[model samples]
Target: MSRRSILRIAAWPWLIASLAVLVIGFREAIFLTPADAAQGDIGRIFYYHVPSAMLSLVFPYVNFLASLAFLYWRRRDPLKALAADALALAAAEVAIVYTTVCLLTGMLWGRATWGIWWTWDYRLTAELLLWLLYVAYLAVRRYSATGQTQTIAAVLSIFAAIDVPINFMSIRWWRTQHPAPVFFGGPDSGMDKTMLPAFLWNFAGWALWGTFILIFRYVLERRRQAAEQEAALVAIEASLEISQ
Candidate 1:
């Protein structure tokens, strides 16, 4: 099969999987999952909130690797560089979307648990800062020129990756009630039996969904780059003809 044919075939499973996750998995998570004893009905938000927050933490690391690949491309392969930039951009965009959801859901979760819309807790504060960093990275890409945009984006993504672990660890290092890493506490923390399966299902679903989104975004970016390259070639030929 041609490359185009191969891509189309490969995308079929992702398409079906995405639809399944969206239609069946999402409803099951929201409606069927039992409420936490402590948090009550509001705990349903966990399906979206926890996944988005975790994804936000991870996506930047993907971007960081892609950015590095883009920056030091020894082969000077435009396609490789393009793939890296495209993936990085996709990861950043999805991370931003997921982060926004995370923040909103977190606030709602907090309101139920703490009776407040926001908190200055260490982990929350650091995550908020990380959100700002991704926003800045997007803005930098938008406002800067081609090569410069890539350079700055790479640097920002790398920096953002460094911040993720710090944000994750902040709650433990400082005194806070962010509920530790485990959802129902730790191994000895006594979790509700039913909740774990739902959480794990949703986590796997999000991982699959995130990959689909990044791949789709990468294809779009590649098309745009290809068009620009064609335009540049056309312009060069036009200038040469004019000189002749």
Candidate 2:
């Protein structure tokens, strides 16, 4: 089958799965999960907040791999490069959304626990920097023309990848103020077993959605490139006819 057909096939599964995940995740986070002993109902934000924050961290790494694939091995594997470009754009967009969710949830969680909306704590600062970088990368892509977008975006993606680690480490290294990790094995690691499955389900759902978005964007890019090639060919033909 053709590339376009393959992309179409890939898209639908993700769309369906993403919808299911959203519905299930919403139900579980708000109504199903039990409240934390410490933060009460507000702790419910973890269902959304942790996944969003983790995925935001994860997407940049995806973008970094894509950038490397495009810049280096692309001559032998052009599809890899194109796929990488598509993934970068998709991942970046998703990261923005997830990061926004993280910030919002963090604020709500904070009000319940810390009684403040904003703080210069390590995790928060690092997350804020990450959000800024994503915005900058997107802005750079927008200002660039079609011919330049991929290369510039690839460079930006590479740089953006660095922020993920910084966000992860800021609290560990500095001990500046934010509470330690909670989910995996941090200070507040005693999680209700029920919450674990919910976390995994939501993570899987967001991941599937992110992958679907990437593939869709890549197909669009391919079509755009094909159109440009066709236009060039037409211009060449017109020139030849005029010459004759």
Candidate 3:
């Protein structure tokens, strides 16, 4: 199958599996797992909030790496570079989706737990910055009519990439209003084992869901690129015929 038409999305395997996993996760999160003794049902937001936040951090790297691949191949192999650019664009879009969820859910959780919708905590601020950078990247691609739009976005993505580690490390490095690390911060960190199944299942479900989204978007972008190229070619051919 052609790269432009190879994605047989009519029967997406990941989509069904992700939905199933998400159903199971929802059950576990809402019915199976015990509520936080202190926070009650509000704590359940962790299942969605944490997974989206983690995946948000991850997809930026995918964007970053794909952007790098785009740069490397833009001159070497145009087709490969186009594919990379599509992937980069798709990843950036999905990153926005997940990070938006992260920020919104976090505010929901924060308001319920902390009685405020937002704080300029290090982690929160860093995450917001990461979101803004990707937003800028997309804005540049969408609005910049220059042929160098992709190149500028690619370079901008590098700066965006630098923030992933910073955002991840913010909580670790500072005593912020955000909660401490749940897994790797000394002996006192980590949730009850009973909570693990819900967290893990939701994490798996969302990861699969994110993957499905990324692939679907990438395929759509490739098709779009293909269409645009065909249109440009047709225009060029029509111009040549007129000149002839």
Candidate 4:
């Protein structure tokens, strides 16, 4: 079978697996997991909120690395550069989706726990900035001239990645309305033992879902590139016939 055929077939299993895992994780998180002593039932939002936020960062880093590879290989190896560019675009789009979820869930959780839906604190501000930067990245990629779009978008992706670190470190670096880190915030930070399993299941499930989305996006991008190339060839041939 052709490579495209194989990829199309492979995507189905990944999609099914991701859906199954996410459904199970949702059940475990919402029904099986114990509520927090402090935040009560509202704390249940943590299961989905945290995982989405974490993956938001994860995929932006993926985009940055892919952008770096694109920049390095762009002149020397067109095929490698194209693959890297496609991966960068796919990662950026997926990251935006995750970040949107993170922001909305965070707002809802904040309203429940903090009595407010929005704040200009370090973490919140940084997270908003992260989202805006990537939205701009997508706009640039979408609107720039074909010859320059990939290079410009790659540069933007790399620079925009600086916001990821700021978003991650904001809680540690500055006091905020957001809760302190539960997993890696030194000796005083941790989650309840009972909640760990649910969290892990959700994290694994979301990670798989993100991977499937990324792959699907990459495949679509490859097809788009192929279509563009075909259109360009057709235009060139028509122009040659006209000149003859």
lDDT of 4 by residue, 36-58 (tens): 88988888889999999999999
Q: Global lDDT of each model?
A: 0.81, 0.77, 0.93, 0.91
Better of 1 and 3 by lDDT: 3
Ranking by TM-score: 3, 4, 1, 2
In model 4, the worst 10-residue window by lDDT is: 151-160
Judging by lDDT, tell me the better candidate of 3 and 4.
3
Q: Which stretches of candidate 3 lie over 4 Å from their true place?
A: 1-6, 9-11
Arrange candidates, best lDDT first.
3, 4, 1, 2
Q: Give the TM-score (vs. native) of candidate 4.
A: 0.95
Candidate 1 RMSD computed on C-alpha atoms after optimal superposition onto the true structure: 2.2
Q: After superposition, how far is residue 73 of candidate 2 from its true place, in Å?
A: 4.8
Quick one: best lDDT, which candidate? 3
- Per-prediction TM-score: 0.91, 0.85, 0.96, 0.95
Residue 87 CA displacement from its true place in model 3, Å: 0.1
Best by TM-score: 3
- Candidate 3, 3-119: lDDT as tens digits: 434457543666889999999999999999999999999999999999999999899989989999999999999999999999999999999999999999999999999999999
